[model samples]
Target: MDTCKNCGKPLENPDQELCPACRAVENAKARTRREEKAGHARRRRMNRTTRKMLIAVCVLAVVFTGLCVTATVMYDKYNPDEFIASVDAALEAGDARALKNLLKGEDLTVSDEGAAALCRAFTDAAQREALRGQLEDQVVDGGAQGAFPALGVEKESVFFGYSRYSLTVHSVRLLLSSPVQNLRLSLDGVPRTGEQTADGILYQNLFPGLYTCTVTGTTAAGQAVEGDATDLALLSSVEPTVFSGALPIADITVSGCVNDGAVITVDGAAVEQKPVNGVVTLPQVAVGSTIGMQYTAPWGAVTTASVQFADKTVTTLAFENPVTEGGVPAAGELNTLLTAHYAAYLDALNNQDTALISGCTEEYKAALAQGVVSDTHKANLYVMGTAECNPAAIKSTAADGTARVSCYVKLTYTHSDRESHEETPATAYRVYTFTWADGWKVSASADSTEEAYNTASMDALP
Candidate 1:
């Protein structure tokens, strides 16, 4: 019997290698193997396609992430709100370096004190709100330019239609002045060289901000002095800002003085120090203060007129000795005698009597006598009243026993004629020459011009 070799099944036919069922089983097994190999090839092709698809997906994901990051960065850099927030942070922190980095300008700098002051100024709620509004308006509508004209907003384009915005600042002019000349100035610990002008010291291209100004100079007395002004705001570009301070002490030279006997008085207070070599170094006396000198003369003490203290200038306090070698009367005695002489002269004219003219010299008496006689011949009786003389009108006194005096006479007189008698009032300015003959006597009298009267009146002393 032929047995099936594969499965040991019985064979019906002879000379068969295997049973029929066994052969069928082998054929089915072979078909199954071919199908499995084809399936495996299909699976390998599918896996390669899947791997390529995965790689493309990963590449797309990475690209999408990069684009997202770039978009976010552009948005933050160009966003007005974000820009403003950065500035607000810097100001709140009072970080001068950060603020300077955020600003865009040529040759711009910020000092720590200046930045701190700026931060303080913006710390107010209302001011911060106003600033925010102004910055926003400047960025959006281009309005509010005048609010901070020196400051502005600039924009630049980046990738993918994005923009970067920055704040631009410009410099302004600062003008400083002081009564102290030759002043060396510094701002924010930095030495500043300035141009001298008629108005003041001009500093150009200075940043607009608060500054600590320091001034140093030598006074008129050759003493070093220093002064400082804090929080000096110079935030305008349209007009120059000015700062003036009084810091210099002035020395006054009292020339024409005989010795150091003159006492210096400033603003009515006598100084303890006296003049040395006619030079008075008034360290405590400020410029523009009133200063005067008082000296004791041979006859009396005299005070010079008060003058405004100027830097390194000479003021003459010349005291002319009123008393000379001759027996000239003192100024006070001469003034009194001249006043009385004018009174007697008016009385003599009114009474038509030469006896009352005893104060006049013999030559003047003869002249007055002739005038009285001439008036009597004309039938004009001149009756005079009230005469006054100003003692300050003494022009000068000479060692030759002669003195010039100006008299202002107010007279009320009755001019009686045969036709009519009239009471008349008259004012006269007369210059008289008085000679010391035994005593003070009026030697000559003449009507004075108005100009001469004014000059003599102005020359009079108090």
Candidate 2:
């Protein structure tokens, strides 16, 4: 038997190296060594795993700390109160460049002058407070509000779940109308040339605020005039603000009279010493001055009602030949002819008697006769009206001795159908041309396009 090298144990048989008791003790020692070795290996592996877990936890802690720090810094940067404070500081210092930088919008272009005007608008303490309140309200309510309202609040960017806000601004437009020509308009010392439109001139991209509006222009008579409207506020962004200038002078045209004896008068005083032509130009008449015409006949003097000079560039003054005590017989003769002709025309239409129509030209009579014959088979059409010439309308005589007269005819009559009778009131403005061949007889007649006739009331007609 072989003996144990270190323990010296006895063998149990011939091939054994040690005795039984000694062998048992040696086996126990060997088992103890093996168990100790295995325990050491387990301790080493556990040490390695613990080290790895500690390293991972350290990395995670560092990363979380960094993220929290970055989040805090971003929150500070985008703080709404701080942002509002910066804007208030710029406003207090009247720093236009700073304010311009703070303002943001789409397609927003602000000039140096416009920015300066904006700064001036909010220089007052009350205005600044109001603006600050609007900004704060936007933050709280998430909408725009207040008198001096902003366009809206905008979210510019986000960082770490933090959002940045920006206040937006918009430019206003102004619509201006002026009777003065070559108009020069300025707002707060900024010159503006507006585009011409159908309604008026349009000045675009103006800053909204209280401004001193200055306007200058050249009158039709080459007169220089200027006007100023202070504290003209343009705050709305929806519609174009309108401004009008009160000019000093206006251009006037006198018409409706061909009589060489008629005199043009202004404010009850004669403007022209000599007789005025049929159509005369009274340049640079003072605004608010009443213009009229005076015609002194052999019997009495007649003056047309005066009209005031206002914003109109060109005004027409109609000369009237009202019925005086013993004035011209042309008006009376025309009235008599129209009264009889109207009666005869109605009789011819209702009774089918074409011969009743007189005081008309031969062609007109023939036309009436044809119409009466054609309408005989239709419903009974009755016509009755009062024919009165406008007293303030034109009564001009051509060089060929033909006279033109405009009159307003009001018709109130009844017509009968097969079932019912209806009475209708109608109005007609007609121009009658008279010739002196046989007498003052109407040679032609048509609808009047005269503006004076259309505007004249029944009380003004005779």
**Which candidate's lDDT is highest?**
2
All candidates' TM-scores?
Answer: 0.47, 0.43
Model 2 scores a TM of: 0.43
Q: Name the weakest run of 10 consecutive residues (lDDT summed) in model 1.
A: 316-325
> For model 2, how does the per-residue alpha-carbon lDDT over 254-370 read when each residue is reduced to its tens digit?
665545566767666676544455666776666666667655543232434445666565476555553222233455556777778777777787777788888877877886678
Query: Which TM-score value belongs to model 1?
Result: 0.47
Off by over 4 Å in 2: 1-57, 140-146, 209-212, 219-222, 229-231, 245-462
lDDT of 1: 0.63
Q: Count the backbone clashes (under 3 Å) in each candidate.
A: 0, 8
Candidate 2: residue 384 Cα off by (Å): 68
RMSD per model, one decimal? 15.8, 23.9
lDDT tens readout by residue for model 1, 1-462: 577777777778757878887788889999999999999999999988799888999999999999999888778777888987787777667677777666776446655554554565455566556667777887776545645566667767776676677767677777777656678778877889989999888888887666777777754434456764655666666778787633545444545333467776766778776777755656635655666666553333243544666553443333343222334345566546655665666566666676787777898888888665456536554554444344546544443223433353333345555457654555566666666565567787777655555555644322
| lDDT scores of the candidates, listed in order | 0.63, 0.66
